[model samples]
Target: MEPADAVTPVDPVARIEAGPEGPQIGVFFDLDGTLVDGFTATAHAGDRIRRRQARIGEVTGVIEAAMRYRLGRVNFAKLLERAAGYLRGESLADLDAVGERLFQERVQSRMYPVMHEIVLAHQRRGHTVVMSSSALTIHAEPVAKFLEIDHVLCNQFEVDAEGRLTGRIARPVIWGKRKAAAVQEFCGRHGIALQTSYFYADGNEDIALMSLVGHPRPVNPRRELAAMAAARGWPVLRVENPGKGNHGGLRGVLK
Candidate 1:
């Protein structure tokens, strides 16, 4: 199924509660900047710096790669590859544990309270809740576990037989169109209908997938996303970064 031909003003939760329910309805939420206040990549980088997990040169290289990516000189995949090179031999098991600890210490508090309510509302209706994030499994899985999301679609590292990172992603990167494709594939395999699904996200690139879903809820959206939502008459929601005083709180125009 596909998004409706005609869009209208409606309450997001009410729409979900009153719409179709069952395994066929998918409710997807993006992690960083949507479900939570900050980017998990930034948090992971800071944690590495504090723990001295990389040599000075390695740190510099990763930072340079990030800058280049930001400057459009490198793609997201290359940036991740450059960063993964820093942890070439690190065991996935160790990183997974670190991810759990990192989320508890750094990310748990940043979750938007209003988003929690939205998630629960979907759950109560027995809809399939999925975390569709561009973050690495190391960063995404912990949050999914905490939220009790039924499925996760995220980037993964290619590992050696020793279960150590091979300095590359195992599959396609979960960003923009690739992310949409992954979700589409999942829905197709599971018999979920996109027209009966809802997706909440903040990135401009997410518009690709947002266009495919029936209910597109743009949360704390980026500039382009905001403009697109406005033009399309999609609901826009904003959740401020918590604990930052004026920087924290969620407000949005559902209409």
Candidate 2:
């Protein structure tokens, strides 16, 4: 099916008109706020680095970028770039270890049960499930492993022959439009139908890819995302944090 040029609303859990055993379809998910409340592993990794090296400027940049990201003013590419730069001379292996530790310490507990259930449902239905994010490989890989997702489309850092980080990001840094492009490429390679695929995300930056999918579900969306979801008639899902109970009102609207 051709990619849609217009935004269309859809039920979050509506099934396609396929039979018990249907054609191949893909279910894409955004990493940060959609599947998990937020991605704190990156922050955790950076903090770990800062504790040893103590670069105030780098730490401050991270804080500023994070704030901008939370405000929806910073896109994933920019955020990933900044985060990668902080580990300029660090070893890739060390960063990978830190990434795993950060995932277990900070990110593992933040996953939403509702989102996990949705992933399982799609898996049982034989859909290809993928985690797409602008987060670097170090931060995204562990989470994908924990979720048992086999495919991932995310940003990566450039490393030297010696396996040291070069403080630069690999090409096509997965962000807004770039992320949409990656999903399209994946569909082309796997013979999946874009018109029948699903994409669930929470960030406003995901609109490009979300619009391309047949079903776009916004989970605990931000202000702009919530407004767009309502305007487009896209389904909105609310999942409480693992420990937090029901939080009502506008604040709850944007998790």
Query: Which numbered prediction scores highest in TM-score against the true structure?
Result: 1
Show model 2 residue runs off by greater than 4 Å.
1-23, 42-46, 68-76, 245-255
lDDT of 1 at 97: 95
Estimate TM-scores for all models: 0.91, 0.83
Kindly provide the TM-score of model 1 when superposed on the true structure, using C-alpha atoms: 0.91
Candidate 2, residue 115: how far the Cα is off, in Å:
1.0
- What is the per-residue lDDT of model 2 for residues 54-127, given as tens digits with 9 covering 90 to 100? 47787788889979987779876778778778878889899888888888877877777767767777877778
Go through the candidates in order and give each one's C-alpha lDDT.
0.84, 0.75
Off by over 4 Å in 1: 1-11, 245-249
Kindly provide the TM-score of model 2 when superposed on the true structure, using C-alpha atoms: 0.83
| CA RMSD per model (angstroms) | 2.8, 5.0
